[model samples]
Structure formats: C-alpha cells, structure tokens
Target: MARSAKAVPWFLFAAGGTVIAFILPVMIFITGIAPAIGLFGDALSYETMHAFVGNWLIKLILLGIIVLAAWHAAHRLRVCAHDFGIRADGAVSIVVYGLAAIASAATVVALLMI
Candidate 1:
C-alpha cells in the first residue's frame, strides 16, 4: 500500500486544531480579558512569566504550539482558497506550507536565542 503525503498535513492540522482549541481561550483571558478587566495577577508578572518561559520544556512546548498553529492555519487557508473557486492547489499548498515551515524555523531560532 502507498501512503499519501496529505496524511502529514492532515495530522498537523488536527493536532494544531486541538491545541488551539485548548489554549486560545486561556490566552485571550490572560492577555486580553484579564489585563483589561484588572484580573491580571501576580502569577503572570514579568519575573514569573520570564522564569516560566526560561525553562527548556516551556520553550519546547511554546515552539510546538506556534509551529502546529501555523501549520493548521496554513491548511485551513488552503481549503478556504479552494472553496473560493481558486483552482491553484499546488501553488497555494506550496506557499502556505512554506510559510508554516519558515515560521517553524523562525520559532526554533527565537526559542534558542531566548
């Protein structure tokens, strides 16, 4: 049996969607709602947040989140473009996935730098 390359992107899309679903709301609450409504707490303070992000595991998790999110977004955009009567699947796939790859690489570099 032959394996289709689509399985890779589909897997990424599914995983990314799952992660985003769980994390996006929490992020919005912390970064947006909490700060705006004065619910921001000491746990999210500069030093605390810095230390949290300073952990290697935290960096890896963040990198995974960012990369998966980008890949998921790319897949969604590709599907949306197809639905919009754009028949350029090859080009769209290349551009979208390429952007995701670039984003992933940049994330790795940034995380390492930090």
Candidate 2:
C-alpha cells in the first residue's frame, strides 16, 4: 500500500492541539492578564519583550507555537466546514491548508528578521 500523505498534517494537527491546549492559556495570562494587572511590574514592557525576542531560543519557541497554532486552527476550520455540509472538501482543504502554510512561512520570516 502506498504511504498515506495524510500522516504529516494529522501529526501537526495533534501536536498543535496539544501545544495550544497546554501553552496558550499561560501565554495569554503572561502577555495579557498579568501585565494588565501589574503582576510583572514592567517586566513585560515593550523593551523587555523586544529583548526577549532577541534570543534565538525564544524565537524558535515562538515560531513553533505560532505555526502549530495556525495549522491546528486551519485543520479545525476545514473539519468544521465539512461538518457544516460545505461538501467541497478539495477546495476547502486547499484554502485552509494554504492559509496555514502561508501563516507558517510568515511566522518563520518574521522570527528570523527579529
């Protein structure tokens, strides 16, 4: 039997879901809620964030999170479209995955430029 091309995207979707489930809420708290509530006390300020992103490791982590999240969202959207009786799986797959690919590329480029 021919190897399934579906494996990679499925893997990414699962991994992305795990990443989003585990990390996203903490990120929201750190970047959104904690800062607003003065929990970090200037530790999360603009200059601090700029310096944080200046690190290669941090950049890689951010790239992974953003790209995976994009792919996860894309796959979920595609599945939802099917469930809603969109019926055009081919076109839906192309559009959703294309957007995910574009998002992944953009994330890499943006991180590298940082």
The TM-scores of all predictions, comma-separated, are 0.87, 0.93
Residue-wise C-alpha lDDT for candidate 1, range 1-114, written one tens digit per residue: 787789999999999999889996787788678867767567677788778888999999898889999999999999999999999999999999999999999999988887
Per-residue lDDT tens digits for candidate 2, residues 1-114, read 999787888888999999999999999999999989999698999999989999999998999999999999998998899899999988998999999999999988888887
Candidate 1 lDDT score at position 19: 83
Candidates' C-alpha lDDT = 0.90, 0.92
Cα error, residue 3 of model 1, in Å, equals 4.9
Q: Who wins the lDDT comparison?
A: 2
Question: After superposing candidate 1, which stretches have Cα over 4 Å from the reference?
Answer: 1-3
For all predictions, the C-alpha RMSD in Å is: 1.9, 1.4
